[model samples]
Target: MTQQKIRWLVVLMSLALIGLVIFQVVGVRETLNAKEDQFDGSVTEALDAVAHKLEKTEVAVLTSRRLAAERRKEKLQQIAIHDRPAKTEPKGRKASPRKADPATIQRYASHSPIVQQWEFYGRVTVPSDVLNRTNGTLTDAEMHYVEEYYRNESPPLNPDNRLRSELEKTYDETMFRNLRKDVESVKARRDSVGKFLANRVVGDRKAAPVRKHMPKEAAAKPKVTFSRPRVSRIDSARLPHRHMTEFEKAEQKSRVMREVLLDMFTNDRPLNQRVDMAILDSLLKNEMSIRGISIPFEYGLRSDDNPHDFIFTSSPGYREDRLLDGYSMQLFPSDLMATDNMLYVYFPERQSYLAQQVWTTLVSSVILILVMASCFYVAMSTIVRQKKLSDMKNDFINNMTHEFKTPVSTISLATQMLSDEAVAASPSMLNRYLGIIRDENQRLGSQVEKVLQAARFDRGEVRMMRDQVDLHELIETVVHSLSPQVEARNGVMHTNLGAKQSIVTGDEVHLTNLIFNLLDNAIKYSGEVTDVSVSTASSADGVRVTISDKGIGMTKENLRHIFEQFYRVPTGNVHDVKGFGLGLSYVKKIVEEHKGTIRVDSAPGKGSTFEVWLPF
Candidate 1:
């Protein structure tokens, strides 16, 4: 009982040790997982904060650039249209004063249609009476000057440029009847210069300057004039809300709201609890209403943080999350402040909870298996020990039977001789008693040899001195030894040994005994006039030795048990064959000691075939 209690204590201590190890492992894993979760949350918060800040900064920069560009355009317009030529100079002035340099005048003319028209009208001469009455000038030269300017250089006084004024201005329409031709020439020259610049100066490596010839006086002080369009203040670009459609507006709003919600999920711990479809919809509507933008949208939080599930913008564009350093990201709206509504998208949170759960389950299962394996190993060891004890008891019984049977048989024979007085008086009765003594002695010797063989095998003292034994020669010798028994049973032995000599590495005596055991089984199991066949062949796996007999064949189930100690087939026929059932078992043990396998294939009514395969 004390020993049993000690065993129980050992088992309990082992189980407790295993439990403690599992608990520590699990606790460490859980703590690591918690730390990882916290780290992930911190990373998400950092990323969301960064994305939100970037979105606002981007919106601000774009708005500043847009407003700045507009202001610069307004200043350029004011510079273009602040001055004018107040109804041509006084009559005594040098026709049109050369106030600026040629290039500056050309630039001034190129930028101002009024200046171009003034130069054209002032340079020409006309009939004094015809021009003076029309432009309110009195002298013939004044009238001539006005007529010359209108007739020779009236680029801006074309019919399409009908600058009607309340001052009631008039000109000889008949004198400018060919005005269309002049206008066409000016347009052709402008187009030529534009094409030349586009195809050569702007598009190629070399450009050829346009040149014109003039007289000595004109060449000494040459002037070129150009016609330029007027510039105006208060210029306008397309407004942000102008191009946006109702559908586009709604899409933009939804995109913005989605971005906001995603940001909340990443940064705010309580964001998930605050989420609902109605709240998102309301948020979008309220934001757009405040901006005086009409939009229709359905908004909700996407279950995941995939980019595809992010903002879906129909107007302006969408916002995308871009990964930055160490678990942070940047979100930037595509359309910027060029559009009426802007959206902000947040960073994504990686899925780690599912991985943690799987790891926990896997670890738990391993712990359970370890505990069960420990228990199974212990139980199997105890059962095997008990089985070994039972086998020793059976061996003792077999040994005792052999020890008593031989002497009793010899004594019985001697007593029978005494009982048969008539035979006892004769010499033949004495010979019978001597023969009985010899037979009993041989049986006793065999039993003693078996016990010694088993003891040697058990103690690992059966040494095998290996040599290259000729298999054909070995088998032939074994067959020669069994010839007498074969003849006694009147059994025909047919041998088909391979012509090629096969050599095996083994102790010659054991190999010979293995062959003899098979032959003995064949002779013992056979009925009268049995045909036993033995054959040997060489194969790649090893040499194969087959022995078969046409006898009372065993069932398939009995064939499997044949090699077990003390296991014998229950042959259905009533016969006088008895056996201790150790022959095949001994053969199997010897074959296995040489690293080989033995198999039997048989069924009821079909003869049994035994095959032994060994690898070289």
Candidate 2:
């Protein structure tokens, strides 16, 4: 694609990504708001429930007290009756209680706690015994009811027949449970008093398991009859009241009592006294948990006029953060807008809780945005790099064409002159033309080799030699070869071999070429009198070879791409410096392959210095 097209594409893609990020952020914000709204609704519901629970609790307490007082009054009346003196009967007759009729006795027996329970439970066996007790007022046939009552009473083995109707059953079940609890309490007390060992011994002697052996004939015989196993008896009363038997009427009365309890349960005190901080805090925790909202909270009851004046506060934290806005509602809001107290509930981590509610969505959105951004970045970077490489390649082609064209033209011209009759007639002229051809051929071959060597290095095809190489000797050899070129240019070359250790492992040919390229660049880009300095010195775990030139140096910008392949410094309309711009680049590769480093120091108008450090 063209540069303009690539730039527009990048711009458009960037805008799209930004828009996508904005939409995702908005979506996450909306989700958080929704979660917060739900949380608020739940909190309000829980608070209302807590208020109702408090009211119900108060009603139950008052009702229990009222019931206890009535029971005490009944007990007082019973005590007075038992302590009262017997009435004077006929001024001299022995005082005697009136005997109750059979009908009255039966009526008393219907209540759960029957009249004279001990004597009633011990019903008289014979008529004479009842006659003696009643002062001969009852006859034998008339006392049939007493005998019939004993006969009709269900035994311990069969209680279902005696406790007829649901009401009686319900009361009987309750009494049975209480009796079991009382027995357990007695056993617990006996064990607590260190009577466990004594009880265990007495129990073993009194209730030891005994197995009676039966005769073989008896065991083989068929069963004659079936008898129910004996069962423990439960204390029960037969309620004769019609209201107790009529369930619907009884339920209606219970409802009326509940309404009275509810009215008494409501708190009527002033808001300040009504809201106990300790009780409110406990209620808040419990109700919030019931609603499944478990988070740290702060609550305070401030005045309606001045919010700063707190009637009650759950904690010091709530007081400190009172200025921060939270959920505010009226305490005792049951009175509508005229509520006296203003209650405020704050969540220190409200924002964090909202985030947690939508954590999965938030994290996924972030990851997707990052992934898209990274992909766009990689795509734009690749385009830029490819464009840069394309420009460099074009520059390289032009430089190569010019470099090759010069040598070929010279060789052609010399061959044409030698072919002429006058030029071939003299030996000097013939030799001159032949020399020109040979020199041009060598020049052309050298340029082709430079290109080929770079290509081989690019493909990693260049073979390496592991033998130790002497840097001092290698620098001298390269200098000797390039000395002729320096002399021709009216330049001077200096070598300062100062390193104690100069041997390194590398390819001999490539090392020679590496040195040749640096020296060549030093000579090519120089003033009228080229002054090149080649030196070797010992460095950290290596030998550093330095090549410097007192010539036109480069700018900082050019220095960046100085070692880049096919990259030449821009000099408008001037192709003064010639080559494929491959020398420095090739030098860098060779140095790196041998476990070495190369750095260059250069600036505009100042001299340049190339430092190559190869480990010994």
Candidate 3:
């Protein structure tokens, strides 16, 4: 390729690489979001199902217990009266009438709301076993009361009053004896019902003994009744039913499976992890056509947020409000051969759609990310190959700077040795050699120190020895150290230490170094008319130390890299500023080590102010 084409290729390649990175980041983010959406949907479904099942179970348990209690009561009454003697009475009150009086039976039925329902199966007719046995016990007990009343029969002197008192006593004795029998009967009945209920509720039929005491015939096959009834609210009765296409049927089945699985997986998890209500509603509304049978059904959720426990139900009515609403179904009771009754399951549909919309957006985003990521990877490989040369150059420069530290240290040692009189012949020769060595050494030392400081700062090895120190004294000392440098460069140093002395806990040596570094940087980087300002005070958060200078000022680009090691501003038309770019880096490290924060406020062609905030 020609140089012009290669250069164009380089630019194109760079753009492509940037695009790829952006795509990858965006794609990953989208994928994660989509996964969360799907998970949430599945969880919502599961929680709804779990809650519904729990509620239904509780209802079932309670109902079973009630029935069991009734049965127990009946059994106990039978056992209590098994040995009672038979009773005979005058014609007006025969113990065993040929049949129970219709009026009396109606009156008894009226007293029991539950008993009226049994009329649907027809009036319960049998030999008067229950009443006859019960009455025999009552008659025997009443006779005993009557005898006692007669034995205690006595008159009060007042004729009318005596008659009333004797009658009251007789009535009281009869009631007392009858109440005793009734108490035993009721107790027996309650026990029987409780035992039956507990057994059935636990689904442990074996735990309860079979009702052997029930009359051989009454204990036989349970009788059931059924009648066909017109279903109300059939809007399309005359509309011809259509057969589902094969593909449509398969799709329906798939949807059902998905709904069922999602419901099972996320049931009763938590609100945040719930499934989309809209999807569940849609699934329920769609009629399933399987094996030429179209079974229309609705799935719903019922949350009974009983503080005692979390309960959810997924049966017809329960699912309506939570998932979908008002799903019409051609539902048949499971015991279809026997009971023929219909219950309309109503669901509130409004909230269902709201939950679903949120879920769809979340899931689709993830898919979008995956698609974008794939596209990004394809673009990345094509552009990444041609940038090898620039990459290598950057690496070489960094490494070269890193390795220059050894030679710089050796030169500094040699400069110190030459400056010593022991290594020189005369004072004049020593001074000349020392001057030469010092000049070269300081030059090398600045470069080496900058690189080493940058490296140490990056590796986090440079540590501060901290102690409680007065801000006033620390700043004064730093100002004194920078005074000589300021005068040598023909620059003036100014200071404004606040009136109240701020005592803070920090490393004095590092604080001093940090302050000196800022001053030195300002003087070196500034124009000939260098004006540096140093100030210390207590700010809102803590102690504030600011070093500001008016120099040639930095360009935005140069300012960006000012704190980078070996990143000297290119002095094309400007005077060379000595030293590697470790000044700010070292300052930044020192300030941070003292649990203080540093910030810079500057702009190109203006002054720069570096602020260090130390907590007191």
lDDT of 3 by residue, 1-616 (tens): 3457656766676676667667756765575666546544543444344444443443454445555665455444443343233332323442332333344444445654334322222212122322223233224445457556855894435874554445444544543344433333321111323232221111111222323244555445354433432223323434234343332343344334333333333233432123344444444343222112132333533232322222223452343243333422221122113221111233243234333535565456556656655665554544443343344345436545554554566567767777676767577766766676666667566566656767777787876666888878877887787788788878898899873658887778777767778888888767777789888787666788888888766677766656654455565644355454556767767777777888777776687888888888
Ranking by TM-score, best first? 2, 1, 3
Indicate the worst ten consecutive residues by lDDT in candidate 1: 197-206
lDDT for 582 (candidate 1): 66
Model 2, 240-324: lDDT tens digits are 1222212223333344444444334332455564556677788889988987888898887776656557766777645546434
On the 0 to 100 scale, the lDDT of residue 451 in model 3 is 63
Sliding window of 10 residues with minimal summed lDDT for model 3: 197-206
Q: What would the TM-score be for candidate 2 when compared with the true structure?
A: 0.68
Q: TM-score, each model?
A: 0.43, 0.68, 0.38
The better-scoring model by TM-score among 1 and 3 is 1
Q: Cα miss at 274, model 3 (Å)?
A: 45
User: Candidate 1: where are CA atoms >4 Å away?
Assistant: 1-353, 356-364, 367-407, 410-412, 415-425, 465-491, 497-506, 527-529, 538-544, 552-581, 592-599, 613-616
Q: lDDT per residue, candidate 1, 298-395, as tens digits? A: 22232224433433322333333331112323333232212212223222322353345456665776677677667667765665544544563465
Highest TM-score, which number? 2
